[model samples]
Target chain A: MLYLGYCRHCGAGLLGLRRCGQGHLLVLCDECDALWQTSDLGQPPQFPPQPDLPCPHCGQSLNGPTAHWASLDEVRQAGWNDALIVGPGGCSAASAT
Target chain B: MRPGRRSVGLTLLGFGVLLAWLVVKPMLPTGPVETGQVRPETPNAGPPASVERPDGAAEQAERPVERPIDSAAGALTELPGDVWRSPGGLLYGPGSREGHRLRHVLRHARDDPDRPGEHGVFDGDQAAIVALIDEAYARSEQGAGRVERDGPRSVVTVDLQRRVGYVGGQVGRRQGHPATRHVRLVLEGRNVITAYPLRP
Candidate 1:
């Protein structure tokens, strides 16, 4: 699966970007369910990321989740479609790396 | 007239009377009508404000005032169904993308080793959860909650001040976290992204 970044807190779940209704971008961790608002869509969230934000749905602190990587389909189904990787070569690069 | 013609004529007359009665009944006064009653003239009285009864009592006649209907309360009534359109024009149901989002929410319903802390877990079935989401959406639309922009989505939060669910993630259940009284609803344009109980 093409990953934008990894969860800063758990360092396990892959991170991706999702756009809100107003076109603002947010970083989402598929495994831990942590979400963060970001100014840049090109760069994924980095470690020591903003304070421990709660999951918007469950309101749980976004600091947990074991080494479980979410499937690409699950991430896409959850509205995380704005991956940093682009084009046909990007897919191969994501797979190669 | 022939007997058959006479019977038909009678039936038509009866039907006309019944129709007239139906139309006139609503216009008729519900209270007793006063007829042929006279009151003694009092000196310097320009007009009689009330009618005096034979027993020397005065009856005040006035139309009863009607109370205004509360439309908001009427809209908040529990509507039957698993799906509902929020006041803000969002469609929420299992048929929409909300189904996928709900899967993530249901994950917090139990204690999972991978997810820790007191995650707000819902305490009811899918129907009940949908109802809660409907209510929260309504409240948020009425400006009784918070709405924050998240790109192409909006996160709405409402505090119902009553136990709508419980906190029961891995460490939360062991710590005996209290029930949640708030709801967080996320919407993408006119579609519901997800909704779930919020930590108190």
Candidate 2:
């Protein structure tokens, strides 16, 4: 339930549909990561952060929100599309912050 | 005066004159390089009698022109996912922002009225295609593009910066839905003469 504020891609706060490496809204987000691909799980889930993953395409550090934990294949597959992260359990009160 | 000494004195005098000439020449400013009054270089290899003739190499065995080292070097002749023809530019969707961007991307390229338009979705697979078009558009600041239907899907071709460019595949619906058509852009000359779109 921990509130993770990150731009999903650059770990930078969402830049209103952030421009990917190609300077286009390849993957964008609004109102937090809400505009990003939304996860379908009714409850929020918890995932560990891997701060070491740098995007191969743009060398941007990847240590942000749960959705930011995407691999190159996944990112490439979802060109300009936001990542959807839904967990089974609801966001814990402590994590919701 | 001894004849042998006189001869030796004359030799010394000549040497001194030559030394003085060398020293004065070094002190004087040298003029422009005059290669024998600028003769015309011809495979005819003969020196031209006239110095006034234009020396431009108009007729000569030419070497094959090499591509630019920055990008034209090791250029990709063809890509796998292609859908449309364009001069090379940005690919925008049907939305207003995207539309404006589309217009911006198309400013440099010309359209191929003869080639019928096709449509396809901008699937992630076609990112390369979009990237290619964007590159071209960036180069020319203008491009030609079109939107069409590929079967039940849709596709778009943005030719912005070059001549004889193309993109292919299907693109359907807007975001929130999975993009379908494969997008691509091929390079050509300074303008876009034609484009071809592929269907899903």
Candidate 3:
């Protein structure tokens, strides 16, 4: 399903959540040239390279997995919880109640 | 034959009685009369207000008062659904995650500029309730966002950022990072009962 929200990096008020071919969720921030996995099941899903799209924050072209995938460890290191990638399927790390 | 004196006297007495009756009618007490259609007691106009009764008792009376919008809004436990594990700062349900109504609410607020205090959920407005789960992850960083049940309603409060404020009496600390742009949401089942933003 497509979910819309804000892009913190560029403060753009839209972001979309879509599943790639492998059934993994991906979040693409077009304004920021950022595409990342919402799920961490396998290697983060790859999107077709967009050489023309430049990261709004750093002006880096988002063309490969190295530049686009948000590692699960990196997210955790940044102080984020594990719910994003786990989907609703059942991630036991945190309970929202 | 001319009217006898007795007949004329009797006629004068009857006229006097009629005049007396007219004068006294207005003076009589007209007790409360029931209208067959009882005006349904106008439902309390607004929030109940505290009023002083003649017996020196405090009572709740219906009055139009601008109820001070509470910064805390309402409790969370009132929401329809059983407590479920809060996953990734988003509270999920008595049912499956997709079926959880609150998921749409938090997502909608991510882009919604207008902070509607309390709102009802309509089928057509489901778009207003969608939030990107990825971004929700970023916002909940540093324990800044939280979702929990307050009563029957679910309360979701998120602190947008950490702020620096000067402290006065702390023996060792001179400054502290305060939470800023805190948004509290009170939800009932599938609807947003009220969303309050409180900054400390």
Candidate 4:
């Protein structure tokens, strides 16, 4: 868990942050789940890690700046809703809930 | 003054009392755990000890005796056939922790990410625990949540309990189920293969 200082949303001291199902960095107050949303990504990337995945839309391997998949907001802003965003296959979560 | 007036007045009084009780109930929390729900005890936190035992000839015997019979022998056999018999949860590997924590964090009345192959890498047991969780929530198409691997093995420790028990990091749906579903698959270690049900 990377220390990200205080949560901007809750003002609670943040010891860490994680990506929620929606691809948002969910800042957690783990004891009580006073969740905070932050735009500032923290401590670079570590843990299970950001995969070197390909964009289902561009059909090209994600590299350099595009390593992580774009959020729904970014996708929409780019007018790429119709693009086929691929799951993180191989490392993709198989249990599709 | 009339008989009908008295009857109506009594009915109104009862309704007022019922409404007042509803507003008051929120303030009266009996304890942290709800009344009907079972309270999950933190394995470490139990009866408070008033004083530390004095070091003496008695300490040797007392310490050994104080330890639970099941735990003292944990090092000998980590994956016993019936692990459910133990009271405390085991330490799960990073992989299993990610697998279990992933779903519990994601699946909600929110954006539903589909969990696939939950049975494979999802938390359950050091052996085939992921396969078990997957089978339980095999209906991944439900758009509940996703399961991801954090390490090589499903490292969650499990304890034998009546309620769903946590394996390394996730709970196994297999230990007990009125209905059981099994699937055949090839996993990490070829020597450690087994058919785990979709649900316990």
TM-score of every candidate relative to the true structure: 0.40, 0.16, 0.19, 0.20
**How would the candidate models be sorted by TM-score, starting from the highest?**
1, 4, 3, 2
Residue B186 of model 1 has an lDDT of: 57
lDDT of 1 by residue, B85-146 (tens): 44444553332111223333334344343233344656664445556777888788789888
lDDT of 2 by residue, B49-163 (tens): 2121122111111111211111121122222222122234222221111112122122112222111122222212123333554453453334335444322212334443233
DockQ-based CAPRI category assigned to the predicted complex of candidate 4: incorrect
Which of 1 and 4 is ahead in lDDT?
A: 1
Interface RMSD of each: 31.2, 26.2, 25.2, 22.0
Residue-wise lDDT of candidate 3 within A1-97, one digit each (tens)?
1223444332331233432222243566432223445433233323232322334344443332223233344334545554543321223223322
Chain A TM per candidate, in order of listing = 0.37, 0.20, 0.35, 0.28
lDDT of 2: 0.28
Model 1, position A10, has a per-residue lDDT of 34
Which ten-residue region of model 4 chain B has the weakest summed lDDT? B92-101
Best-fitting candidate, measured by lDDT? 1
Q: Write the per-residue lDDT of candidate 3 for residues B1-200, one digit (tens) a residue.
A: 36798899989999999999999999999986542222211211332233323221221131212211111211123223433222223433321111123332223222221212111111112121222221233354445577665334444566644321111112112223122344444444433333323332
The segments of candidate 4 whose C-alpha lies over 4 angstroms from its true place after superposition are A1-70, A76-81, A85-97, B1-91, B95-180, B183-196
Where does the lowest 10-residue lDDT sum fall in candidate 2 chain B? B61-70
Q: Tell me the RMSD of model 2 versus the true structure.
A: 22.3
Scoring model 1 with DockQ, what do you get?
0.01
Taking the candidates in order, what DockQ does each have? Answer: 0.01, 0.01, 0.01, 0.01
